[model samples]
Target chain A: MKHRTFFWFFLPTGLAMFLFIALPIVSVVTQSVFAPHEAVLKTVENCTPLVGCTTETTIDQEATREIREAQPLGRFVGLDIYLDRGHLAIAELGEAWDTAETWGDFWDRLFNLPLYRALAFTLTFTFIVTPMLIVVGLMIALAVNSLHRHLKGLMIFFSLLPMIVTPLIGSLILFWMVDSRGIIGSALVGLAGDPNFSLKASTGLTWVMLIVYGIWHSAPFAFVVFYAGLQTLPKDQIEAAQIDGATRWQQIKYVVVPHLMPLVTFVALIQLMDNFRVFEPVVGFNASAHATSLSWIIFNDLGGETRQLSAASATSVLTIIGVAILLSPVLVRTWRDFKGK
Target chain B: MASKAQRRPLGLSILIYGFVGLWFILAAFPFFWTLWGSFKVELDFFSIANWTNAITGERTKATYDSAFTGAAYHGAWVQEEFWRNVINTFMVCFFVVLTSLTIGTLGGYALSRSGYRYTFWLLITALIFRAMPPITLVAGYLLPFFEWNVWGILPTTIIVLVAINQPFTLWMLHSFFQNIPKELDESAKVDGCTQFQAFRHVIVPVMWPGVITTGLFSFLLAYNDFAVTAMLLSESNRTMVPAIAAFLGTTYTEGNVMFAVAAVVSATAPLFILVMFFQRQIVSGLTAGAVKG
Candidate 1:
């Protein structure tokens, strides 16, 4: 029988996407509204003693800290998943915001600390990584493109090999390389005068390492696409540019870059959408390194006991929004530029 | 492989080689190290032993056997009984490829020949699914699938990989179909053949290159993916990449023989054959869809 004869063929793919990809996100968004019903808040009350704290404000502060420094085995109280309902204002006019007893005893805890913080972090990570990748990728592409044909092909293939290795493998290489006895380990000890030197766990260094790793993982395809685009440019125009006595830099900047603009725009937007869901490499190394992206947070929650599917789903929703927002500027630019083209 | 006559000066060649050499090392260091580690004992791994050490030396079958045979290297060296895994890997790849090819081909045919605006919608979904992070899917819905026992390993993996791949494969094969001239199909129809028969005989044979290209790539995705298969497979049925990943992710020190084993399965053995046998076709296959500007 013909496949299209069944309604399932056409319907299943779309249905699956909606049921899985979009539904999780929608449920997550609705979770912000579902907030936490009264009974769910009981888990948070239990959490208070689990993490030591005497007063309400201190407890809230401590809870916020715990959420931020989320252990792999962290308890998944559904309430702390929301944003800054930590303060709990009692003296507001009506009965909307007043919570006199516990941090979880909230009627209106929409978007608490962890939720917003993760969203912000995910956005920031995406913002930084995307542009860095584009710039670095273009530079490498240009350099590789200028080489002789034989040299260029070999160089390109070697350079692109990183894209094939799994992020888990890549991160393990990083962990081993930068570990004390590994390549950087002995070198770091020789230079920094300490045997125990792990650049991965250090705060700002982690961000830098992640961006480097992300670029290392990603930039090859961009280089390949840009190279392909460059290769496809009309040879007559290049010959004409040379005949007209344009310098190499002038030819590259004016003609080559313009010619590759469409490819650049496509890569930029794709990378923007793709980078938001950063998880594997971060978790591959350690849970603490999972700080910069929300996907990692969702994965972190999913692995824990309560498994906070509701909160993780909600986080995925915000992550979806964050991805849309991240892409909006690039997308709008692409639309305009593409239309102009 | 073509050596063009425009040879640069020797000094510039060194500079280019030096720069590219460092970058390649950086890119390939992990794979190289994994290969090395896969042969060395855990004890030998920590210590800077003799020059033939697994850290930076030739990884061979003898080293692998020693790692397995001898229990003196810190702890007993980890060896995945390779033959069962080899069979399991074949089953996973074969089912994944077969399933993806069927859906992708049918879907691609519909999208290309259907001549509807919905094809564009299908195209968009394909791009998004292709671009969507694999790790996101694993944590997001795969867990739910596993918990519910909705589908077992072979069925579930085949389903997931096909769904994930259908959009891209369809997208890939659409252009291949478009390249086939409509006149042949029209001529066949004019001679009394139906649309389905015309496609099977006339269109498919002509688009053999497209089928081969898309099929190989779909196979690559199936073979290369760890994130999807990691969440899906238990110890009883791990794919090549995820099986190797277990060595790295574990708490105890294990011998690196698994890395060589994985490299052999995932990249070394099959790819070596594929590349050697059909290098030109494989290159064109990748370049046709992916190398486009």
Candidate 2:
């Protein structure tokens, strides 16, 4: 294709992306540095009357509005919002480190900061769920691969449900079942012989539930990918291994796993990006008290009347950085491939 | 090979089937359970007094003079005007899919055909955009939309969704176009077709399978999104997912959690239907990216 034709073809999408995706990113960074204008206050004193006079301060609403309108992005606070306790919390970290008697104590204090708390959960969820879903998904793919042909589609149909349903709805379905009086919770109570047991009450249990939900929700994706990989497996190689008197497990250990390694990495890369923005499950489970993610923190900040745009924007910038770091490997690979070409 | 495969142990087969069956139940039973529970009264659904009430629908029988009731559905769909949100959702999805696909096909085709370094950078840029959480972009959009007084409208939300959706759409369609063999358009051009004419006449017809697959995914993203719709829309213009989220806030106080339950089921039913019909396209769409990457 001619370069001119290519330019015309790419123009619409390129423009849309630039306007919405690229522009919004720039806007988010700009918004992060600026805080909303504070209301102007004025003090008045009257001494003309012979009696003693008192002064009163009041917000000059018109002046405040004017300033806010004149500078709609709000006051430029430079890196202040990002450095505040709700975000990077440099000062609080310093204070905690200076005063703490032990490293554990210092770390505990650090994690109590809002951004750190969110980051901790987000990282834990991402690291744990990506590997876990990959393993479970691989097992499922192997099992299903062993199935008869007619049954495969039926199994896939069932498997896709958890993945296909809206995330919030999926989590809510599980949440209802895991409620204290619901079937699973009731069954757990029976097994433990503790009528008061509830999955919602404890942080550890809630984390387990969310992680389980994460795996259940995403494992199907890994399964489908691995299943596709399994289809094109080298039959000749497998037969060679078998003819060499290798055991079934040995054949799989050496031949199958190595073949599936690329698919595993593919699943891992996609899952990492998807899981890092974990927000819906937290909302569905209503487990925000026990667990919070970066996306959830931004959502919480943006939810109410105050709007907290600067706070949300700060978190947004930090999240973009996290995504970029996670994605650097893939980006580098693309670059190398382009250069090679 | 068949003889050797048949020599595998019977117990192993049984174990594999057993595990697979267990997984199927784990994967599928939640929707069935929720659907069943959605029909019963709140007491029977939750079953504080007796777990068997959930299955028996004993409370539902007493309350509605039948073992099953659509009262929850009625309450959600009629009383709460959840249908409007449902309508809003479809409207948004319809346009989002249309706009995203129209531009995405063009851009993706161009990228596939081009041999320039910029194509690589553009694809990488789209990848980075795809990786960013939609909520992060929401923070950026909030101020500008508010300033322009364009916040809380369906058109704005739809445009935002299409833009957020463009990166994935481009990547998928680009890959799809790559698989089509460049000789197709080349032959068309040799036969005296202009580039655009070749695309319109030859490439477009052959592109349906891949495009449809991509379109299904685009539909899913637009339909399944919560963060963008929830944040970008207002109370009156909310879509079904966000509307359900709103229901959670009010229904608990009203002792009508069943309304939210009904809304969830309503929201899920379409997706269930979608899978039943388009499972092949959906599966192909999902694996295409992974396999290619």
Candidate 3:
């Protein structure tokens, strides 16, 4: 009777995921195969428009002055800023700059430019941060856990502050700190007695700062999860290891780490999924000649002409594939490992 | 006690702690910078700047005054893009929450508690949504949805946002429902409570934390989003993040203080309120699968 009554459970949630999530993902594959440059061009040529062409976002002259003046290079162009658009030649921003022309060539560059670079950066970032978080979180958890059983209920609540701080805001806060002229940077400059000092002047240094910022905003979750996972572990396993004269390192490596593999895998997977979604920081950073990520690159494509969306969508579809191909192994391993348990 | 304390390199611990502590300060500074910037005027930002030759420091309070006024010199936020975004945000939040909760709770209870029909298909459905990149999905069909709308871009954006959010809320709710034991519900029904009554009295009480977490997450997703909103929304319906982003290299020339201030205030409000208040409930269960614990 219970099972019979509950039969309708899947429809609402199932249908929603189908119509929205699954359908869009499938759309990516279909669109990629079908949305060749020529096809997209033809579609744009035929379609009327998403919005009326008469509409324009005309900025007030005074405000526009401040905006134009803010640019390090006088003024950066608007949506039509894509160098290869129509007949404009992109003055290569640097020799390091990768170039793409036409929608197809651009598609190649999409993969070549930031896709893998961002992917690698994201992966490395995750690899380093997740472990750090777990360690820090575990230590905090142990300290909190050992004090008293009554502390468990309260400490558990206290440990969740970072979850409430959206990653977007977290990233932004980091951005301002290491910002070229931000207070910390200013202090560093003052110490050096060099007014023009900027942390971003050193390329490697800049990346380190970015990674450091990522970990700061993210570590709390790792700590809390390890803390909770710590609670679930039996006291006897560690006690037995200690009694047997196992070093603390041996106990953690065998007893603790083995117990934590599932949780560690879960944390790594979630962070990996989110790491690619790195738009907030890259966007918020608001410094440097260029700061592009896989997500930001795709986002930039959409803001161009309405016709560019198909091309943008194509890149997005490819990105989705890229992620699937990359994460498939890790995901499968996680599933298999969990199933083995 | 002294030997124990002196066993390891004391200096290394200090170095590690210092690095971590400094990182936390850096991680959390932009928010405070925004808070400080929000209280000041545009002129003040220019004069008392972070740098003399640096671009970020050059942006003034005037940029902000113009953003709210949209008049460059004087107007109202109500007449500006900011007010409309707030309206759009509120409407989107209200509808998304109400609809998604109803669907997720009902669906979750049935999926978790009962061996119901088509459960396989439903689980697949949830997984599929969980899998896709949101920005891409929304961008692909912006035209299709836009054509179907009448109120310029507002209606189209609202619909798409709601659609993007439904899956996760449902998934989270399902997990919430599953965590409770079947005995709790059976016992309640045995005591003369109906199915709905058991859910309302017994299950709902136990699972309120999950519901709140799901709601808060969805709301944040809706609120903090920039890429999807930028892709789907037209200028008039532009949300605050994109608007500030646009302002970065546009309206105020390169005056970032406008963006600096607005980004800080608009983005931090909900997060600050939620984290500082229901900090535990926010993290407790919703992210359980994602985190180790």
Candidate 4:
């Protein structure tokens, strides 16, 4: 294809991405370094008859409005927002480090910061969910592969339901089921023999609930991909392994898994990216009091009466950085593959 | 393939069946349970007195004189005017899929045909964009959209979603186009057809399988999205997912949790139909990227 034709063909999609995806990234970075304008204050002196002369400082609303109108991007604070307590919290980190008596104490203080707390949960969720889902998915694929032909289709159709449903709605369904008065919650109460044993009341149980939801939601995606990979498996390799007197487990370990290794990597890469953005489940589970993710933090900031754009932008920038880091391995491998080709 | 040596033992077969059955229940029970519960009143659905009330709808029978009721659905769809949000969701999904596929096919075709290093970089850029959570972009959009008075509207949200949908769409279609032996279009060009003509006449004729697969995914992305729609749309123009979320906030306080339950079930019904029809396309589309890699 000629450069001109290629240009024309690619122009619409490219322009859309540039304006929405590329430009917003730049906008987010810029907004992160800037803070919304502070209220303009003025002092007024009131002299009462033989009583007192008082000077009161009040917000000059008119001046503040004019300044904000003039510069809607707000004033540039140059990383002040990034370093503030709501974000990186450099000063708080230093205080925690200096005043802490032990490593556990120091760790507790670090987790108290909003950004670090969110980072901890996001990373924990990502790392935990990705591997567990892959295992569960592989198990389901193998089990389904061994089923009769008529049952395979039915199993797959049912399997896709959890993944195909909207993330928030799926989580909500699980959330309601696990409510204190709901079936699962009442069953747990019976098991524990404690009427007041609520899953939502404890941080540990809430985290477990979210992680279980994550696996339940995403495992089907893995199963579908692996099931497809299983369809293309070579018969000769498995037969050869069988002829060598290999057991079922050994045949799978040596022949099946090696063949599906690339697919495993592919599933891992996709799931990593998907899991890192774990926001909706947090919202649906209403687990923000016990657990928060980076995406959830940004959502919380952007919401409500405040609409704290600067804080949200800072967190957005940080989240992007986290994604870039998480993605570096895949990006490097892709670059290598392209160069080799 | 199921020869004597490959046959599973009775014990193993039983184990596999047990595991798969358990999984089947785990994967599907919640939706059916929620669907069943959505028809009952709040007390029976979340019964503190007796758990069996959820199944039998004891309180529901006492109040509505029926084991099942459409009262919740009526409350959600009529009293809350959730139909407006449902209409908005379909409108957004329709435009987002249409625009995404239209532009994506062209760009994807261009990338597949052009033998240049820049094509590689463009895809990589798209991969990066795809990885960034859409909420991160919301912060950037709020200031500008509010300033321009374009925030909280369906059209703006549609365009944003289409843009977000581009990267994955391009990658999917790009790979799909590559599989369509270049000879088809090249032969057309040899017969005096222009490049555009070749694409329009030859390539387009055979591209429906790929295009339909890609379109299914685009529709899913636009339909399943909560972040962009929830933030970008106004109260009057809210989509079903966000509307349900909003329902939780109001209905909980009003002791009308059944409204939210019905709304959730209603919102999920379309997705259930979608999966029922397009299961094959969805599975193939999912494996398309992984298999190629």
Candidate 5:
């Protein structure tokens, strides 16, 4: 296609992305630097016939409103917002380091910061779920590959349910079943021989439930990709290995896994990005008390009567940075592929 | 020679089948259990007293003179007025898909056909945009939308969603367009046709499969989104996901958890039908990236 033709063809989508996607990123970065304006203060002195003179400092609400209205993005605070207790918490980090007597205590104090706490959970969820899903998906794909042809369609039809459902609804379904009064929770109580036992009451159990939810929701994507990879496995290679006295396990270890390596990497990259933004499950499971992610923190900030836009913007910048870091490997690979082509 | 001997050992086959059976139950049993529980009264569905009450609808029978009850669904659909939100969701989904696909197709096709290095950079840019969480973009939009007084309406949300949907739509359709041999359009150009004429007469006819696949994905992205719709929409114009979330927030403290449960099931019912009808397209769309990459 000619340059003019290409330009016209690409103009509409390009303009939409520039206006919405590119511009918002710039806006978020710009907003993060500016904190909301402070209230204007004034001092007033009053002398009354019956009382001594008194002076007081009060907020000039009218002046403050005018100032804020004039500059709605608030005053530029540079990196002040980023270093506050709600975010990087630089001062809190220093205080914790100064007070701690040992490494474990220092680590505990570090995780106490809200930002660090959220980062810990987000990274833990991402790393744990990605690899576990790959292994579980491979096992499922291998087993299903060996099944009778008729069962394949039925298995796939059922397998897509958890993945295709809305993330909130999927998590809600699991949440209800595991509530203290629900069947699974009740069964657990019976098994433990204690009626007071509840899954909701513990931090560790809730994390486990959330991780299980993550694995349940995402494993099907891996399974489908790996299953497709399994179809093109070389029959002659497997037969040759078998003729050379290789057992089934050995053949699979040598042949099947290597063939699926690219698909494995594909699943890993996609899952890492997906799991980093884990937010809906937190809402659906009501696990925010026990678990919080960066996305969840941003959502919490934007919500309620306060609508803390600056705070949310700071966290948004940090999240975009985190995603960019996770995305670098894929970007590098794409660049290399493009150059090679 | 080794066909018979190559068969798995009987014990091994049994273990594989056992594992598969277990996974099948784990993958699918949650929906079935929830669908069953949604019908019974709250006490019987939860059943803190007797576990069998959940399966037998023991409390539902005592109150309503029937083992099954439609009270939860009635409460969710009628009393809660969740139908309004459902209509809003479809409205948002319809416009987002239409606008995203309309532009995404043109841009993706252009990028694929153009033999220039700039196409590479554009795709990389789209990838970066696609990777950023939509919630992050919400923070950027809040101030402007608040200032302009356009934050809480359906059209603003629709346009925002279309933009959010653009990156992935472009990426998916770009790959799909690449799969269509370039010769189809080139041949038309060799005749007495301009570039647009070739795209209209020659390329469009053969492009439905790829476009449909990409469109299916765009619909899923718009439908499954929570962050954009939840934050951008007002209380009166909320989509189904946000509405269900609202039900949870309000109903949980009110001792009406079943309202949220019913709403969740109602929200999932459309997705169930979608999967039933378009399973192939979804699967193909999913593996399209993995297989090509």
Candidate 6:
């Protein structure tokens, strides 16, 4: 293709991405370093015949409005928002470090910061869910592969349901089922022999519910990928392993798993990128009280009557940085492949 | 494999069947349960007095004089005017998918055909864009959209979704186009067809299978999105997912949780139908990326 034709062919998508994806990234970084204009203040003095002069301070609303209108991007604060208590909390971290008596105490204080708390859960959720889903998905793929052809299609159709449904809707379905009066919740009450045992009341239980929901929502994706990988498996290699007198487990361990290794990596990388943005489930499960994620923090900031754009932008920047770090390995590998080609 | 299965131990086969059966229940049972529950009243759905009431709809019978009723659905679809949101969702999905596929096919074809290092970089840039959570972009868009007075509307949301859908679409169609044997287009070029004419005549007809697959995914992304729609749309123009989210806020306080339940079920019905019809395309599209990698 000629450069001019290529340019015309790619122009629409390239322009859309540049305006929406690329430009917003720049906008977010710019907004992060800026803060909304503080209210303009004025002092007024009133002298009365019988009383002494009185001085009052009031917000100059007109001036504030003019300033804000003139510069809608807000005033540049240069990383002040990033270091504030709502974000990195550098000062608070320093204080907690010095004032803590024990390592456990220090850790508790560390988790108290909003950003750190969200970061902790996001990382924990990403790390735990990705690996567990891979194992569960692989197990399902193997089990389904061994099934009769008639049953295989039915199993796959059912399997895709959890993954195909909207994330918030899926979590909501699970959430309602685990309500105190709902079946699963009542069953748990009976098992524990405690009427007041509520899944939502404790942080640990909420985290567990969210993680379980994560696996349920994403495992099918892994299963489908691995199932496809299974279809293209080398028959001779499997037969050779069988002829060597290898057991079923050994054949799978040596022949099957190694063959699916690339698919596993592919699934893991995609899941990592996804699981890091764990926002919808938190909202659906109403687990924000017990657990939060980086994406959720940004959403919370950007929501409600007070649109805290600067605060949200800072979190957005941090989240983007996190994604870039998580994506670096894949990026390096892709670069190597491109170079080799 | 057939012989191997026959030679397998009985206990092992039984275990595999048992596990798959358990999994089948786990995967499918929740939607069934929810669909059944959505017809009942709040008390029956949440069953405070007896868990069996959820199954039998005891309170629902007491209230509506029937074991099952369309009262919740009526309340959701009529009283709340959820049909407006439903219409809004479809409109957004329709435009997002159309625009995304239109532009993505051209760009993807260009990338596949171009023998340049820049094509590699463009895809990598797209991969990075794909990785960024949509909420982050929402932060950037909020200020500008509000300033421009285009923040809360369907068209704006649709364009944003199309843009967000581009990276994945390009990658998918790029791979698909790569497999089409460049010789087809080259042969057309040899017969006095310009590049555009060749694309229009030769490539377009044969591209539907891949295009359909990519379109199915594009539709899914636009349909399943919550972040962009929830933030970008106004109250009157809200889509089904965000509308349901809003329902939770008002209905919970009003003791009308059944409304939200019905709305959720209604919203999910279309996706169920989509999967039923396009299961094969969805499966192939999913594997398309991973298999190539």
In DockQ terms, which candidate is top? 4
Worst 10 residues of 2 chain B by lDDT: B1-10
Q: lDDT tens digits, residues B1-293, model 1?
A: 32232335687567656766666777666656645554554434343333234444333334654443232222312344444555666777788778767656655665666665556556765665565565455545544574588533656776677667776677778777767777887789888987667777887777777888787777767776665676666677766666555655553354453343343324434644554455445545544654453
DockQ of 4: 0.90
DockQ scores of all models, one per candidate: 0.28, 0.84, 0.29, 0.90, 0.86, 0.84
Q: Lowest lDDT 10-mer window, candidate 1 chain A? A: A37-46
lDDT, candidate 1, at A74: 36
Q: How well is each residue in A9-50 modelled by candidate 5, as lDDT tens digits? A: 999999999989899989999999999999999999988888
RMSD of each: 9.3, 1.4, 11.0, 0.9, 1.3, 1.0
lDDT of 5 at A337: 88
Error of 5 at A267 (Å): 0.6
Higher-ranked by DockQ: 1 or 5: 5
Candidate 4 — which residues are off by over 4 angstroms? none
Which of candidates 4 and 6 reaches a greater lDDT? 4
Question: Each candidate's TM vs. the true structure?
Answer: 0.74, 0.98, 0.72, 0.99, 0.98, 0.99
Q: Give the Cα error of residue B87 in candidate 1, in Å.
A: 4.4
- Report the C-alpha lDDT of model 5 over B1-293, residue by residue, as the tens digit: 44775777899999999988998998889888888988999998888788789899989999999988899999998999989998999999999889998999899999999988898899889888888889999998988898899989999999988888888888888888888898888888899799889988987898898888888888888889999889999999999999998888888789788888888888888888988888889889899989876
Q: What is the C-alpha lDDT profile of model 2 across B1-293, one tens digit per residue?
A: 48664366988888899999999989999999989999999998888998899999999988889999999999999999999999999999999999999999999999999988789889888989999999998898988898799999999999999999999999999999999999999999999999999999989999999989988988999999999999999999999999999999898799899999999999999999999999999888888988765
Better of 1 and 4 by TM-score: 4
Judged by DockQ relative to the true structure, which candidate is superior, 2 or 5? 5
lDDT of 4 by residue, B1-293 (tens): 47888988999999999999999999999999999999999999999999999999999999999999999999999999999999998999999989999999999999999998899999999999999999999999998999899999999999999999999999999999999999999999999998899999999999999999999889888888998888999999999999898998888899999999999999899989988998899999999999977
lDDT, residue A339, candidate 4: 82
Report how far residue B94 has shifted in candidate 4, in Å: 0.5
lDDT score for residue A4 of model 3 = 45
Please, what is the whole-model Cα lDDT of each candidate in the order they appear? 0.59, 0.93, 0.59, 0.94, 0.90, 0.94
**Candidate 2 local lDDT, A200-250, one digit each (tens):** 999889999999999999999999999998998989998888888888888
Ranking by DockQ: 4, 5, 2, 6, 3, 1
* Poorest 10 consecutive residues by lDDT, candidate 1 chain B: B69-78
Which is superior by TM-score, 3 or 5? 5
